[model samples]
Target: MASRARGLNEDGGFVKWDWNKNKYIWVSKDEINKPSKPGHSKYAWKDGNKVAARRPSFKVPVKKACRQPLQVANKHGKMKTPSPKKPSRRPVHHKADFIVPGYDHGYDDGYDEVDEKENYPRNEKYNAREGKIPPPPELHSGHTTILSVMSNRLIHVNAALTFWRQGPNEYISYVIRTEDDAATVDTLPALVNCFKNKTPVSKQLSLGACFELLPTLKKLLSSKFEDYVKTSLDTLRTMLRFWWNDLIAHRNQSFSGDLQQSRSVAGIYMSAIAMTDIITKLCKRKDGIAKKAEIVGTLLAQL
Candidate 1:
């Protein structure tokens, strides 16, 4: 007769946690032997069959064996089969900006059954929606984006200081990683505008606002800067060709990726052209990115 009882000096069978007692309690009345080796169980399935002198368990029939079954049985209770609900699909609206990712999956746990619903996307134009540039970091939004809009044109600058000054140690690195903007002569008017009233606003940007955009650029370029520059220069040639073709496109959407994804690949090329042109003028300045590029190139060669 199997009976549940508290784990006294002799634990009958497998012990279960008793939350009320705050100690392990034996749940069965079977006579079980404890392991001799410290923290090791002799009845453990791995060496459960091994006897006092390496005697096999199969040689001695289970009917005449010492160890009894650990499993507890309830005659009244029956195992249940989970009946999964059929998932219904909604018609795809062509005007929707996003794609539906996946389907719904909900399973049963006894009487408790949950019906989890799926998510919806914005529209059918996937890249057009994805390619849309996000808002500023310092706004009421949840992001700690380093890039903040400067002037009417989009300019990426270090906005980490903006958030940190507002509160404690709060800065976002993703906004900085995606930044490609470097200071140039064309930005002089913007920088000067920022210093209006002899005191620059926290929202405005200057040469000081532009630090190492990508931290990895410094570490990785210490050894691979020259190679990266060389490869970038080669890639720049191809980008220029694509940019020219895109510029000469009769229809503005001709250079778009696909029917669904209307993302233009020429935007970065145009930004690169603007920066390269600015760096050409920055060559005259003592403190310019062109010199930094050369320094990095030289350091890469030395390393």
Candidate 2:
């Protein structure tokens, strides 16, 4: 028979834990080796004083994993399946100005998603629904010119600043007449107004406001200060175009790589905006070509 009770002591004696004494006590090895009583032998055991064979057990069944599909919210707050198709290079017809993913040149430019959505063109039909005049025919077409793209981008930036209520107060006085005027400008039509014969409200525009209205500011300042205005405008446009191309290149190079590059792109974009303001001030002072050249050099070096 096998010993099934207690453990062997250092002295080679059988011992078991004593709850009352709080220590191990000696036990009789012969008594522990005795067979269990016949009445308690219900479970089959191979030898006396051995634990009965373990009862067979069945495992609980596992259920298969279930996953839900992804969904996106439309402008109307309705949930719909995300479209796999890329946004058309042309204008999209929609009831509201909705921000569609994969629209900004189909690559991340390091600007936050908010900036991407804010920079998009205003939906033409959405404007008409609000009882406002639609923009020019060319602006609504599939193929938009580089000048138009730049102008539209500036307008949208102003509109975004207006939406966030961070735009210069001078903008309100210049654009707003009655209290009922629309909060945001109709972009394309507003761009057209920049080239019109009417003078921009120079007195109403501040440095910060001038940065927001680049195309119109060129018109405004060129009228009063012609010396550096034209050259500065050309330089600024070239700088913006180069910066945009650089962003596209960086996006291609580092799409799946380091995020630090993305952050740098965002910083450069903001720096360009700051440079625009600096150039505006320079134009206001009629700063000579030498100073403009130096500033342009510095701006290019940072890129």
Largest lDDT belongs to which candidate? 2
TM, every model: 0.17, 0.18
Candidate 1, superposed: residue stretches over 4 Å from native: 1-224, 250-266, 278-303
TM-score of model 2 (CA atoms): 0.18
lDDT tens digits, residues 1-303, model 2? 987676445334477876456699877755667765644232233344333323221221226642211121123356467889987786553324444344443235554443444454667444544545567787757565666766765665565456334323444444433221222333223322332322353223233433344444244333444443444444354434434565556555566665554454655555455555545455445346446545554554444
Clashes of 2: 0
True lDDT of residue 60, candidate 2: 17
RMSD to truth, every model: 33.0, 32.5
Model 1 vs. true fold: TM: 0.17
lDDT of 1 at 226: 46
